[model samples]
Target: MLVGPRPLTFVAVALAAAIVVNSEAASAQPDAGTSQAAKDAARELATKGIELYHKGRFAEALEQIQQAEERYAAPTHRVYIARCLVGLGRLVEAKAMYERLGSEPRPREMAPAVRDAYGAAATELTALEARIPKVAIAIVGASTGAELSIDGNPRPLPAGPIDVDPGSHVVVVTNGERRAERRFSAVEGAKVEVRLELAEAVQEEEQGSLVPAIVLFSVGGAATVVGAVTGGLSLAKVSELEERCVDGHCPASDQDEADFAEALGTTSTVTFAVAGAAVVTGIVLAVVRPGGSSANTGAAATSAKSIVIDPVVAPGFIGVRGRF
Candidate 1:
């Protein structure tokens, strides 16, 4: 974010001077009683107006200043009235009054006050002419008082039409642990809007556990080992039968020979069955583990929503009050 030039303070100072000048002029007039009354009235009104202005009550200040102007006809009083108008956003009237004041020459003592007032008006006009672009960011998921940062610099919430260089910027919106980011481009005098929604954090524990997968692999390995042993035993039995029976006499009728062949067949069948079951069990276990790509069968779980980023002209960040 780019910082703009500070507003000129002369206008406000001139207004103060005007109020003092008018009060003093009223006091100096002939006829002590009437002059004293006018001075008292002007002083009271100007004091109230100044107080109101300080309190950010520009509208009320305008009212008070207007009343003072009606009760008195003095250039000094008019200057203050104009200042009040400027504070109230009535620029046209304020400009006219400032212009009128600028045209007249002032006494040596009043010269500084006049110069200050002119300077303030000139600063205001310069600011107005520049027309700084304002962007409003409304965050929905965070609280209104959530902190806002632009390119790592903290900025006040409900910020003014921020005067920014015409270019791109990175905006970060954060509240406690939740955070969102976006990029935007702005042109001179253009308003940019942005809205952000933070994604909830995903806990590691919720992802499937590796324990089940490890257990399955262990079981499978044990089964495979047992199957290989059984297969070896079956092959040995067959080899022994053939060796003892000689050529083709491997025992159709011989009880020992028949028994040996039956034992071998049974062992081979059992071994294959155990191995197949183990392999299937291992596969199932791997699929059930947390973080596995396959769907889990144990329990239903929820996942965080994916964040969406879109370009906008205005600030786009919001916050929620409670934790998820």
Candidate 2:
């Protein structure tokens, strides 16, 4: 027997339809260019979302309700969104939503249904205040470039208390190359404080360049070769003087050559001592002066602790000395 539409079927069909006549529909007037068809579609989606929420399917309900608000742009939908966020264990976002709703004016011209939704958001926020977690962060010795971040995303430092979800969170403070990080758990409705400490700044001297060492080594090597050649000539001259003057006594004729040879020997000895000291100083510098090469650019540049190495060259002294 063919029967008229069954009671359950009629109820389902009614639930599927949009409620255009409700007072909630009057809350925010349609935008300037909104078409009648668009309004009807948005209303239908909101209706479906409400039904899903009653059935305890909060995630699906949140998506539908969010779309409806985006389509219609109503403040009343905030209440529904916040409710769904609470159901999803996202207490922080839900608290922000409720706080935003509370700060907005309850439009005196609002329809009764919209006013009721606003009132409901206010009442809900009161209870949520006790269940939400509060977090405060303070930076000690923070530099001018210091910045705060939460979960890897940059955020402004809170002047007062900030709402956060219960559980573990990463808080970071960064100032140039210096960074401070903290990871900890927060309990619901409890206050957590974090102090970020900065490390002390160090003063370092500028590094010595390798060019000076290389130059010194080259010059010293040349000087040493010149000194050796002069020394050999001076020795040969002395041998001739020794043959001419017998028993360490130089005759008048050999006296002039003897004085010249003595003078040459002194010059050679002084030059050799200076050259040896220079070469030793250059070698020590090349060994310890770090990566001052022009080839090392960008990150390849090395910073090394430096000490002043001096070439000590005197009439009788030739060595390398260092003062840290």
TM-score of each: 0.45, 0.57
Off-target runs (Cα >4 Å) in candidate 2 are 1-19, 22-25, 28-33, 47-63, 106-116, 142-159, 172-180, 203-205, 216-279, 287-318, 322-324
Q: What TM-score does candidate 2 get on C-alpha atoms?
A: 0.57
Q: Report the C-alpha lDDT of model 1 over 169-241, residue by residue, as the tens digit.
A: 7888877777888888776567898777766544344445557556646665776676677667767767776
RMSD of each: 18.3, 9.9
Q: On a 0 to 100 scale, what is the lDDT of residue 113 in model 2?
A: 47
**Per-residue alpha-carbon lDDT of candidate 2 for residues 49-121, written as tens digits (9 for 90 to 100):** 7667667788998999898877766655667788878877688888789788777654346654465566677
Worst 10 residues of 2 by lDDT: 1-10
Report the Cα lDDT for residue 257, model 2: 83
